[model samples]
Target chain A: MSLDLFLNQVVPVRQKLFRFAYRLLGNEEDAQDITQDALMKVWSQQEKMPELQNMEAWCMRITRNLALDKIKSRKYRLADELDRAGEVPAAQHNPHAMAEKNDVMGKVRQMIHELPEKYRTLIQLRDMDGYSYQEIADILELDMNDVKVNLHRARKAVREKLQNIQVYGL
Target chain B: MDYNQIIAILDRYWEGETSLEEEALLRRFFSEPHPDMPEPLQEAVPLFGYFQEEIANEAALPDMPEIPVVATSSARVVRLSPFRHWMKYAAVLLMAIGMGYAMKQYQQREVKASLAEIQQQKLEAETRMAYLETKKALELLAKNLNKGTTQMQKLSYFNDATGIITGTN
Candidate 1:
């Protein structure tokens, strides 16, 4: 493929790629770096872009793999973000913001974070980024039905946990 | 949207039945709650809000960096064929056996040299002892012979004197 076509097809997905990484890894710096890394990979393989089926999804997959590797390297757990809820009052004096420590969304974030990786990733791709089901399947290399099933289970798991957070104010 | 309609849509949403469009509608409905929005669905407002806040908090993506075109691995990867792998092991085995043989030969040579040195020392010591023993035996023989010779000479003289005297008698 010509450099212009590679530039056109690969460059525009930067924001979406960043968003995907940022959602997966709640760290913006790491997300930006992952986006760059993924893009660089795509650019390196520019000759193959013409035959590539879905450039955006392919790039997203690369970003997803790279982000997951980063997460694993750091031994970072999304589960730990919620675990830090107890430690939130170290310096913040705003009582309202401090109360955000125990907010439902915080619990939801943790619940989503605690999800099995495939479920969490599919949920993030579908619910947070609003990728179409097919796009998610393409990126994740899962069939559409499996994607739907996993997304359903992911949402249900979060909702079930949120039910607990509501009942006992976890 | 009627409260019943929203409730119905949320039911479908939880069951994973809502289309992307329907889900988008739910997000819009919860984006800013109407004053009379159903109390039950109020909890969903933050969930949708969380998604919004999460995606919106994107760091400004910087422009692509200049990726230097590094050489690919295919150019560098040394794929050893099965035959080559066997050849490698065979070469290693041959080297090891050759080294072992060379070492054994060196050791044998060292043993032979030490044994020869030991035999030479032993032979020199035995030769020196035999020479000393022979000298001691010859000295004893010479001493005894000298005493016999003296006795014989004396006898010879006495016989001569007796022959002369007996002839006159």
Candidate 2:
């Protein structure tokens, strides 16, 4: 497709991509850099883009690779260091909030963070990105059935973890 | 609590047997405020709720940067071809060296021509100096010859004077 049409249609999805990266990396700066780098790469390779079957998925795949590389390189640890140094503001804890609102949500996020990278990624693609199983499979390079199976297990694990947290209060 | 129905679908879910519609049904059932839900299922609601929140919030994510569309009319995978990369550097180096060698040869030829012209000029100057010296010597000789002729005329006048004096005697 032409660059204009690609940008017009695909550029609007940058925020969603950023959100996905932020959710995965749990750091805004890293997410922003990854998004920028991924977009730049996509921009650079605009000449060899695949057919427009799923531009967003293609972009997500690129973002995922970049984020994974960043994670592998441990470059994100710099952001983590900054976060620890109080340079970065902590997420709101809201100590006086309702149990359902704060504790449950907090536990859910913790459970998601605790999930294996593969499961977290699958869940992110499916739940957060709203990709279909086939699309998730395409992005993750897994079988269609494998995508469904992993997603189910990932959700189930999160559910179990949350249930334990609520019941045991630990 | 109808745990059996929920359990049945949950089993299907784990096996990847549930369709999107069935999954949506599970999400709907779990998200609703049902007082009859089992303790385990009730505890699971918030997790499902979080998933729902994440999905709904997906639309609310910050704006993503625009990705430029590459025209894929000739959609070939672009790898940096090793040969092409090498050839590009090779061509640049070749051009640089070729220009350098050409410049060196040109300077050498220029220096040689300058030396040859300077030698020719020196030879011409020497020839001109020799010719001038020869001409100066000839002029000097001519001046000496003219003085000799005047001396001979004086001598003849002296003889005429002596002859006149003697005849007058």
Candidate 3:
């Protein structure tokens, strides 16, 4: 029964878990390792399955913790911006337009990345991953109100930066 | 969609009051090009555009490696012989023998020490006995010598009397 539940429910979310870890660690290999470790952890703690209401959030929480621990243990720096400069596939036809678009997107990425880890994680989890505030709260082990307030602050900070960029073209 | 509605949603989004649906709607709205984009919407375009691109890129990530199945019920339990850890048993036995030898040696030393103490105590008692006997013998000799002195004193008295009688004066 436990194995079946694991294969059905927990195994299917490895991609999401990997993406979440990747966003946190900013490295594919580390993200993959963290994902596998999270799965193994979930599998090992199968006795808690019956009591859990949201297994996916628990799995994500585990992945986030592992990734954060890795970041903390090694004082890990995210991959260099130049390393990911070509990551976003360009859709523009003109060379100049593509370069400009890439440049703008890179700035946006950098802006988000410059936010504190908590704020960056909140933005990515809510805006990019489309997780509900409650799900995010569960994953982050925070109160729902705290999640909303922090997310509001994070978005506000980003908007201020965005306004600056729009006005100064910086 | 009306520009006003987009602006309202964007405001709510900035305040973090927008639901997931509204956020998704905003993402969809920004994904398309607006020929005459409003001033307010321009600031959010890049941000939403980045989110859309990030989502796309994440979606394009390859599937994770296959997970191995963990068997729960069919776990095999192998029976073990009693001497699986013979070295540990040997170690324990050796330790016990060593402790026993040490205790025996300690007890033997204690017995020998007590015997020597007893012998020493006996010698001390015998010496004390000899000293007391010698003391008693010397006391008797002293008493006899004192009696002889008194008799000699009496004889000297008698001799003086004889000398007086013999002088006749």
Best by DockQ: 3
TM-score (0 to 1) of chain B for each candidate: 0.44, 0.42, 0.48
DockQ of each: 0.25, 0.30, 0.62
> What TM-score against the true fold does each predicted structure earn?
0.61, 0.59, 0.71
**Candidate 1 clashing pairs?**
none
lDDT of 2 by residue, A26-113 (tens): 6777888999988888888887665557778788888888888888888554233234244222565664545446556666766776
- Name the top lDDT candidate: 3
**What are the runs in model 3 whose C-alpha is more than 4 Å off?**
A88-92, B70-169
Total clashes for model 3: 0
Ranking of all predicted structures according to DockQ, beginning with the best and ending with the worst: 3, 2, 1
Q: Write the per-residue lDDT of candidate 3 for residues A53-170, one digit (tens) a residue.
A: 8989999999999999999999998987877866756566788988887778888888999999889999999988889998999999999999999999999999999888878867
List residue ranges in candidate 2 displaced over 4 A.
A50-52, A75-97, B1-7, B55-61, B65-169
Q: What TM value does model 1 have?
A: 0.61
